[model samples]
Target: MEARERVVKMGALKHHSIVRRILTLVVSMVILIALVNSAVINTMIYRQLLTEYKSKGIAISQSIADSASDILLFRDPATIQSLLDQHLTINGVAYLVLEDAENNIVAHTFVPQVPQALRTIYAGKRTTTATTAFHRLPGLGNVYEISQPILFGEIGIIHVGMSLKPIHHSMLKVVAILIPILLVVLITALFVFRSRLRFVTRPLVELADYTKHLAGHNFEQSLPEQGAIRAIAAEHNDEVGRLSETIVSLEDAIMTYIGDLKRTTAAKQKIESELMIARQIQLGMLPKSTDNTAFETVKIASYLEPAREVGGDFFDFINVGEDVYIVAGDVSGKGVSAAIFMATTMMLIKAKAQEHIPPQELMVSVNNQLIALNENMLFVTVFCGKINRYTGIFSYVNAGHPAPFIKRKNEALEIPLTGGMALGVDYHHYYQQRELQLENNDTICLYTDGISEAMDVAQNQYTEARLAQCIGQSKAVSAHELMDDILQDVRIFSDGADQSDDITVLLASWCHASASVSSELGVHFTNDLSEIAKLHQVVDIYSQANGLTKTLQHNLKLVLEELIANTISYGYRDHEIHDIKVFFTVVNNALNMRIEDDGIPFNPLEDAPEVDHSLSLEDMPVGGLGIHIVKNFVDTIHYERQDHLNVVEFTKSLGETA
Candidate 1:
């Protein structure tokens, strides 16, 4: 009985194999015929519909042009509307419009307004004959538009649009009917022939099940091969047989790959851990928060954010005697390589800064050192400056960096770029030095391109112009507050965009110590004699608040009035108005005053005449009396011509206010 059952099974498989091939051939031919028939039918119907619609549109437009000529001459919109309505009722007529030669619509058969796309038909050059083209209206779908010029477009024009939506509907209907027929034939063929072929497919199913089982494990050893899968792999040499053999081999390959992956993952994790430690170490290399006690009158604030685990922007401050060296630099590129280059540049800067050399000389030294060590050809843009904390003189050098901003009073001005190249590019490149005079409460802002070139989602940058405006608005605030506000503004402009580069900002403010609660006062006025009274009022108020004696107040008022009167009277060569600025600071029972004016250069110490005791007041020259009084009232005075302005500074030691 068992032998008989085996014979029957083999015979059934043989019969079904023949049936499968015949059914497959019949199904392939049916699908190919259906596809070819649908494509050919759709193309023929679309072309026929387009040609018919275009012809109908052109015929209607020409008829309207013939009938509307009288209406165009009479300028009768009602008759033109009647003519358009008559033609719009025709089949597939989407819209009809009548317009004079000026392209102004006189009549349109539309529920609302005609589509603006139709206007271009006549809006172009005048069409002597009937012209036709295709267009897609907003609500009307595809359309065949035709235009006819009446009396060579001098009198008027007629437009007609025929809808092409019917062609699309016909094509869809053909596909819908043919697809179901193809599916029915395929289903019948599969059910009749494929159902009997399960005898041949059972072995394949067993191989698939064995493969899935093998995939679920780490494959500590080769899986026990199933009998059915072994039979297919060994007994037959067809596609199924080859697939079974490949799966058996794949089990061993997967086990080897898993071991390698585990080792690679562990190694990657160790590398990441090391990188994290390196990031912390790199951060520790940066200078700490400045101790206010160390930098007596100068307030410094800095902010740094890296685009990755490490970045390339750095800033440093080093004090040497009475001067402080400020450095801000950016190494090209980003990530670990840039961070290493940045670290190198920073170390070189510190080494050179210890020498207390001028900014330009220091830059030259650092540039040469970096070039020697630069194997990757990396470069850095640096801005280095030295500021005399007491004298308020800042000498700076730019090395292909963005110009820093100076916030004096309520204005933010960008220092002009000095012609220099970035470091490590060329050893012989010479750097130029520039100087600025910082007064009380003035701020210097240093930054990298990250802040200025920060981009929003739409790629708009936080430009330098906007940065200047922000600084100007945040004027008079402390360095810490200003830095916070600037960072906040940058955040708002970026609007959650991913940061692409490192960001660093440094703000240094000059806030000289003063005895009074109000540290300093700066006043601006034109060169007018009447401005003296305002000066007196200011001097009196300030001196009184600071507990100055009546004698000291009188002397202060007298000295300022004398110097200002001399300047307003003789400093100008023309009657045009000129501005004068005065700044006052009091510290330890002493008054410091600085006067600046853009007038003819005059140094009171050199230009003033000598007052000799032998010469009477009447014998003395007229110009020297006022200056001699000023010189006597102030204990120490200095004058210089800088930036085309006369700068006169004086300090008076008022002995304890009694």
Candidate 2:
């Protein structure tokens, strides 16, 4: 209902816009003017005609009075009456009467003149000439009554009355001719004015329409081209033309701005995506905290938090024989530059630590290499050391970094770290070797300045004393728990202050070596793929017995089908009996699977060609998806040619890697 009302109102507005209302106003004004003019002219003409008729009556009465002087003096009314009768023959002249000055009827036409017995027999006025007045006599129409002095009121007044019919008829004739011509002129004027109005308003209306179209994004109708818009500009050099040109200019400017905005938005989104990917890759490079883990010969945990998406803090661990190496480092500055330096430094440290090199000696080699490759002259502070898990011999190098704290399980006293020259500061600087024999329950907490120098909302640094106190209070907590408690305390102390630098903590202790753990499940099945049921039963029993999650069981089932199916489907050249062996082990906090089949030598890892994920389903190749799924679920894959057996083994860490 409202829509209908709106449509009606809009239609009215549309009709009214194009000179329709203006034309109505013009026509109304013209008709009013014509009627007023006609009325005024007719009134003036009627008055003038009445005046002339009165004057004629006066003259005729005077003439009759002059000639009737002799008759009236002798009192003979016959001659006087004959003179009055002659005047009555004229058209529109109803009657003429000659009466005595005493108002006695003397002569009259069409009726007998009243005698002195009448009501107004002698209504008199003293005048030298004729005087006239109007009268509406019953059945005689409108008439004029005039009287004049005959022989200076001596002979008797000669009264002459004339009807107004002739004047009214003449006035009617004039109006009859004027009205039709006025109507025709008015109609023609309306048409001409409306046509002229359209020319002036058409461009403006179209400009409004086009502007609305652009704003509404209603592109069903094609927009006018530049040439067409320019035509409007050239057609009239008025405001409408200027407006049209302005609309065209605005359209171009708006479109250009929108396009630039889209491009800028897309580029920003792309940069954000790359930064997200860089953050994942960076975090993945650092080892996860693992003090809760019961393996690795010690309880070592690490937490590296960046102020930004990427930061320059790093931590590492390596197990060689009965010794565990722990390292924590910070690159100079922060953000991207520091992150790059941190990555390079981590690679170099891991490479050297794997060789079982001494900490001080390893720092010497790492520092020189950094100086040679450090075109930006960046420096790094590192605290790297090795701890004998059994003998509790802690040996380390402190390179321009904060001291590593040694807190005993039962003592509150804090051991401060020693300082030396920072790496990349000199090409041949030898790092200091410091050894502190730790007791069985002593803990070593290595850190970057980001922790000791961390600021709260009040701009107060956490300070080395605070870290020592926190560790002392939390001394009985596990290594991972202690790290978490320190972080939580710092977070609460900061009171939501943003982490302004890279905060890294590498915690380790040569307390007790975790008891070794291992799980093995092997099932033997024939060549038939349906015999896979026996393999599934073997894995399910082992998984339930070891408290493995249901999810792992399902994943292992799919793994069995993919790995064993490949062997059964393609390993054999004939329909003959073949053996497939599948086994699983839980060792060193990791789940390891080894599949050995007496099939052709096929390394699934290297043989599985890379898949193009960008391809559509119809265009994507189908066979290697199962292998890809297995890799996604598993952390590591190893393929070895053990004699005639194709041994495919993979391991997934149950906790952080050492």
* Residue lDDT tens for model 2, 367-465: 988988899988998888898765678888888887778778745454445567888889899677878788765678888888888899889999988
Best by TM-score: 2
lDDT of 1 by residue, 1-658 (tens): 5754555566556555666676778678878887888889888988887888777787888778877887789978787888888888898888887778877888888778776666664575576777787888788888777888898888877878888877788779978987998789778867765764564465565675576567566666666664557678886677878887777667768878878888898899998888788788788888776423135457788888888888899998887656788889999998888999999999999888888899999999899999999999999999999887666788999999999998887788897788889999998789899888888887889999999999999999999999999998884477777888889999999999998778899888875544222637887768999789767766765676677778878988998998899899999999999999989897676789899999999897888876887977678666578888888888889999999999999988878662
For each candidate in the order shown, give its overall lDDT on alpha carbons. Answer: 0.81, 0.76
Highest-lDDT candidate: 1
Positional deviation of residue 37's Cα in model 1 after best superposition, in angstroms: 52
TM value for model 1:
0.44
**How much lDDT does candidate 2 score?**
0.76
For model 2, give the 10-residue run with minimal summed lDDT. Answer: 113-122
